[model samples]
Target: MNIATRTLLVATAALTGLAGTALPAASSTTGAPTTASNSCPVKAWGYRGHYMCGTKLKAGYIDWNRDGRTDEVFVIAPNRHIWHTWKNAGGWKEMPGRGRADDMVGDNGTGSRSRCIIVYVIKKGYRYYQNCHYNGRWHNWTTSG
Candidate 1:
């Protein structure tokens, strides 16, 4: 074969080999769910901070470990008091104290008072440490019962 013809054939063969070896660009799409799961509960207190003063400490919801369901309820007092209650327990139970400063204050403005309760639903074996005030007064979030 002539030089020009031979060169053309070689180029064509190279192009064909490249096309056979190459693949089309892959898609960059994902298949993740848009909404959150039902098991994972939402947190009333976004962070580990005190809520607004005199907000009438209410029971807040949280998933804690994010399992998609609210299994735990937390009672948070402005005086840094924390109580962990579960759905199965049927009642509230005080957690061990960490000896931290009070988040709420007393009428005298010197001592602290229990004024809040936050509820959190977390998975089993999930341990959380918090500092809170435990004055003898039982502050209920739902009602004055």
Candidate 2:
């Protein structure tokens, strides 16, 4: 075969191998739970550890905070409990009040997965919050005006 053709084949092979390696990382997002319990079902309101709060939480898309744009939420769960934090137009803020904001129990044979537990706050004019869980911790984010 021509040198150019062989070189093209080698480059294609290298690219194919690289692409294959990346697929696993992409699929890893759907893998097992990192720190939180995979079997915990999210409840609307329940006991999350010592703190009573909301459950079955899911992170929402990023949006404007009164001041301007902000970073996304980040969460971590080491084991039973989840910890959350976020960056806002104002700055970084940890969730207020100590305690679990939400709780979850394993779901029955309904074929549904465990629910997410999260905490949030709403003021007179402001409404709603965003949240996410990653690396064994929970993150809560919101916009304020």
Candidate 3:
């Protein structure tokens, strides 16, 4: 092929490849990937160092790594479960899981640089139980009796 035709074909192929792959849209505020869908109910909230999800049945942030700093923002998904979205070097990512996070406090000494996550979960009938995320994973439920 001629130089001009070859260049055009290469450009077309590049464009086609991009079109076939879905790119994560970026946010103007944090420049992170806007991977959380519209189904997430807490996009308007901006994490202000620390926030507690409380009485109003609202949304807040969780220090999943327990660095005593805001790490991920929690939102109630359309499925009625809580999901966390956080940004790293790779941009924003949604933490996958089930159930509502009713409350959380302290790191419980489960991590190196951060506090462990001590979360209270709501399981059927407005009941909540405490659980700890230690050593990079969640321990079994400690039901509130």
Q: Rank by TM-score, descending? A: 3, 1, 2
TM-score of each prediction: 0.27, 0.22, 0.37
- Over the stretch 1-145, how does candidate 2's per-residue lDDT look in tens digits? 7899957754554333212211111112222123322333221112121111234333311222323442232222222133332342232122322222122221111212321333332223323333333445533433212
Q: What is the C-alpha RMSD of each candidate to the true structure, in Å?
A: 26.5, 20.2, 16.3
Off by over 4 Å in 2: 1-36, 39-57, 60-62, 66-70, 74-82, 85-96, 103-145
Task: Name model 1 segments beyond 4 Å from true.
Answer: 1-60, 78-80, 98-145
lDDT, residue 124, model 1: 31
Roughly what TM-score does model 2 have, to 2 decimal places?
0.22
Q: For candidate 3, write residues 94-132 as lDDT tens digits.
A: 333333343443234444543333344343343443444
**Model 3: runs farther than 4 Å from truth?**
1-41, 44-59, 63-69, 89-97, 100-125, 140-142
Model 1, 28-52: lDDT tens per residue? 2211111212112222322222332
Q: How many clashes show up per model?
A: 24, 17, 6
Candidate 1 lDDT for residue 119: 28
C-alpha lDDT of candidate 2 relative to the true structure: 0.28
